[model samples]
Target: MPETSRPAHPLSADEALRFTASRATETTFFFDFDGVLSPVTDDPDASQPVPSVLGVLEELASRVARVAIVSARPVSFLRSRFGSLEHVDLYGLYGLEVWHDGDVVTEPAALPWVPAMAELAERAKAELPQGVYVEYKRLSVALHYRTVPHLGGEVERWGHEQAERVGLRIQGGRMVVELKPPVDQDKGMVISDAVLGAGCAWYFGDDMSDIKAFDALRAREAVDPAFFGVAVAVANPETGAEVSSAADLTLDSPEDVARFLADALPVLAR
Candidate 1:
């Protein structure tokens, strides 16, 4: 059952700080890549983490018992993006793959579905509207219409049609449509696996896909009161309605997210 109670809001810097300090000892931070740690961009491949963002994450990772980057991108892609950021663990393909201790561990169950998903995406690229760009991530497929804003509806409709035709599930985000196998691989499952047996879990994201993680965290807390944490959503203009509604606290932007983390680490360390 969905947890009926909404998580508390972190409206101001003071409230956010107090929330963090209160759960400091139990918290384990999980960040989304595209718009949480790294800035979003027209060219997804060009999006990289700002220097200050990386520095703050490094510091947080050092202080926290667990710090992970959970992204929809493939594990290898994340590895390439953050080549030597050894401090943080990488949960890629939306928790389908985990890069830990210089090695990659993927859920064997998800491996066989990758090639089939890639092929489906390739077909989507050919069938979708002219400006709709298909991103083949092996484990998942994303149709981006941020470039062709006018065709957003068509992109979504076609994405859904294709997902249905291919027996996949549709996942929508900021100007993008995604198709993934009907598996239990989501940010929520990732957080549950990573933090369920641990002290606490805090997840930060800026898109609809992230709400799953927020829901998961809260549900876990409800079931196990000892598991305490926060759910932070980056408030971008493009943030989805569902994501905003599900978030416990909303920050102004990725810059604000980095600043919050930077400020909280020192206090949490104590």
Candidate 2:
């Protein structure tokens, strides 16, 4: 099969409806939190889902076999962000943690890597350029330069170096650099595990970390001819070129993603 290029824009409501209808029998939906459901902000702590997102997700979850959030944030952070919503399943730490049914299940071994990551973040703050900022997320460390665009390249290189030295992986996102343990648990792995052999799945995201999930879903579809799904990218200016190219569809922003989800649920549920 020939590889198709990624679309520059999201599917229209009609297109989404047709796509969903085609996979009505076995469809699951996975989402990313920041920039997919919530707007991206200078302060990550200030980011929150649009008022309607939770309601839309709740409705969509009732219709689909599963609704999971695969995010780069820690499971605890994700819980604090959207734990009140009963319908959504949370996959945090870039898939290292899973929260469901009011219970948090984690890969205990990954816990030990937290302090090491923090130390790396501290070193980045001290060594990187003046504009570079580090976010120590216990299980992950993010070097951010959104506030200082000129330092983006410097921060990115510093993050890569730190990851190499620590034997961790570098996950680049919008205006940020993340370091995490070298694990096979990526967004795609998390979605694949959550679906449990489901024939169809749709994943929406807005950053580089989401590319793994897109690749995983596409690979699964290739392996099983009956599998069908779409990888939707919410296009923010901050998103990397590689991430945009890897997506099947690209929406304008978090608002657009919410609109797409809201419109798709009713038809998909039928």
Candidate 2 root-mean-square deviation in Å: 4.4
Q: List lDDT for all candidates, in order.
A: 0.78, 0.78
Worst 10 residues of 2 by lDDT: 1-10
lDDT of 1 by residue, 1-270 (tens): 223232354445455445555555556789998888777877777788866787787788777677889998888888887766778899998888899988899888777888788788778877877877788888888888888999998888887887777778888888888888778788888887788666567789998889888988878877885666677888777874557788777777788887877778767665
In terms of TM-score, how similar is model 1 to the real structure? Answer: 0.89
Supply the global lDDT for candidate 1.
Answer: 0.78
Residue range 61-125, candidate 2, lDDT tens digits:
77877788888888888888787779888988877888889888877778889789878877877
- In model 2, state the lDDT of residue 8: 24
